[model samples]
Target: MNVYLAEFIGVAMLIFFGCGVLAGNSLKTSGSYGAGNVAINIAWGCTVAMVIFCLGDISGAHINPAITIMNAVMGTFEWSLVPGYILAQIAGGAFGGVLVYLQFIDHWEKTDDPHAKLTIFATAPAIRNNVANFFSEYIVTFGLAFCILGMGTNVFLEGLQPLATGCLIFLVGTSFGGVTGAALNPARDLGPRLAHFFLPIAGKGTSDFKYAWIPIVAPIMGATTSGLVHNALYKGIVDYRLFAMVGLTVVTFIAIKLASEDNKEAIKNKQALNQIA
Candidate 1:
């Protein structure tokens, strides 16, 4: 099969299993409803690893437009193939979303929360502030790209690289996923979100297009920054410590901002409750 076809299949598998778990965990009446974050982290991590293990040799198992675009920008992958890879990944993601919706059709009617239904297909911020949400995606995606580049340099046993990479995803999701749902890929968000918009699910809410740009744009920016830094550092043309310091700074900033926002929100909630009383 062609590389494009392989990418489609690989990404389909990634989304099918990854978002499948999200659907299972969030949709009412599903056996795995409320299976919790650990389950989600593990399912996504394992899905990625399984896709890579099965299709890496065939298509390099990019399975993510952000990864594809980053590699292309970094000169590691061909520019000519970027469009095909991205398109395939998005289509595959949509395909996966449709499958999950069909699988959980009954649950959609049973569940009252539209956001929960949306979560099964795409991501949203826990606390919605544009700047903070954007930064949340950026920092985590930077970590993702940086770690992926680092993983490539390591001499792990042939097939073990995928497993290691999967673990890195799990680590990032657990550590940095609190604010923004850890969508490190544009296709992962966009394709499924489009599916959510068009799919005939019962009582599903607005697709939340207002906040959609953060995931798509921020991940690309983060991945590009990581690729440039990785390429420079790998060639000894730049200091690795510089990236470490920058990453630390960004994380610190995000933490402070999120904390401040949370406190403000808490005060507002309390004030509203007191007024009601």
Candidate 2:
């Protein structure tokens, strides 16, 4: 099979199991309804492993546009193939979302909340602050790409790469996934969100396109930053510039969180004042 085809199938499998888990957990009347975040984190990690184990040899099982873009920017993957890889992954994601919709058609009708139905197809912010959400995605994907780059080095065992990568994903989800549902991949979020927008799932509700760009843009920025630092560190230069870049990113992430909290507090105070008046 062609590399592009393998990427498509691999990512499609990723979406199939990943979103399928979401649908089962969120949609009413499903067996896994109310299963909670731990189940979701576990399922998503396992799905990543499954796809990589199956297609790793064919396409390195990127299964993520962020990974593909990072690899290309880092010069580990050919830039010429980046476009095709992204398109294939996006297509796969949409296909996976469609499959989930079909599987849970009855459940969609049973679930009256549009947000729940939409979440089965894509991610949304827990706090809904754009800057904070963007930084959350940026930091999460930075961690993802950074760890993935480390895992790809010669130190790790070759046969265990997929399992290691899956574990890394699980760690990310549990540790840093709260803000924006941890959408560390553009295709993983965007494609499914698009599916939710177009597909006629009864009362599917708005796709929340306003915040879609956070998942897409933030991941790319994070990936690019990680790739550059990883490559520089891999080359054994021990450059201080890498540290500066990382420190700046950390500070930015912290600032966003603090700012968002301040904004929420202000809103609450204003509400209280209005009530008193």
Candidate 3:
């Protein structure tokens, strides 16, 4: 299969299964009541693992712009192909979100809660705090990218890397998902946000545009930082023994201090702009 085609299919499958869990939980008539955060997180991890297995040979199964960017930064993927991969991923994700909406249109109509409807389509904080939410996404994406970098380096573990990636995602979700719903993928968040904008779901809230940029910017930063860290470690600029300890310590510190501060400032600016408007 062509690489672009594989990306399309892989991303579609990701959204289908990942968003399927959201629909299962939120939609009243779906018969999947009580399926909560743990279920959604596991579904996301498994979806990623399955997609990678299905399309790894054909496309490396990035299915995410951040992953593609990281690969390019790490010299694994050609820069020329990044646009196509990102486009395919975004399209597939949007399509999958639409499919989920179609599957639960009746339930969406029945649910009068705007936040609940939007939650099914996009990520929101369990508690509405900019600092914690941004830190949550930053840490999750940083951990995920670090794991990807490690997997990319170990040739002997290449075949098992997807499973490792899946496990990292599971850990991140299980550990820190409560804050921001673990939207570690920009395409995953924005595609469904777009779906919520276009789909005829009543009472759907604003796409939370105020906080939307965090997932996109933070994940890219995390992925790029991970790539740079990996290169440093591989080149012996940093001791491999200290890689995890130093790398994670740096990532966590940056996430908590820099990203969270930036997010708070952005929120303040957005609120100021809204007030002026």
Scanning candidate 2 in windows of ten residues, the lowest lDDT window is 236-245
Candidate 2 overall lDDT versus native: 0.85
Residue-by-residue lDDT tens digits, candidate 3, 156-233: 555677777787777888888777878888888888788888888877868787777777766766676666677776
Tens digits of lDDT, candidate 2, 11-104: 7888889999889988879988998888888999998998888999899899888889877866679999999999999999998888888888
Q: List the residue pairs that clash in candidate 2.
A: none
Give the Å error, residue 39, model 3.
1.5
RMSD for all candidates, in order, please: 5.3, 4.0, 5.3
TM-score of each: 0.85, 0.86, 0.82
RMSD of 1: 5.3
Question: Candidate 2: where is the Cα deviation over 4 Å?
Answer: 237-277
Residue-wise lDDT of candidate 1 within 1-277, one digit each (tens)?
Answer: 7999998888778778888998888877889989888888998899888988888889899888888888887778999999999999999988888888887777889988999889888899999877788888987898899999988887987688899988988898777766889999998998899999999999899999988888888887788778778878787645554466457657855765786689789999999999999
| Candidate 3 error regions (>4 Å) | 155-160, 237-277
Better of 1 and 3 by TM-score: 1
Candidate 1 accuracy as lDDT:
0.85
C-alpha lDDT (0 to 100) for residue 61 of candidate 2: 92
lDDT value, residue 265 of candidate 2: 95
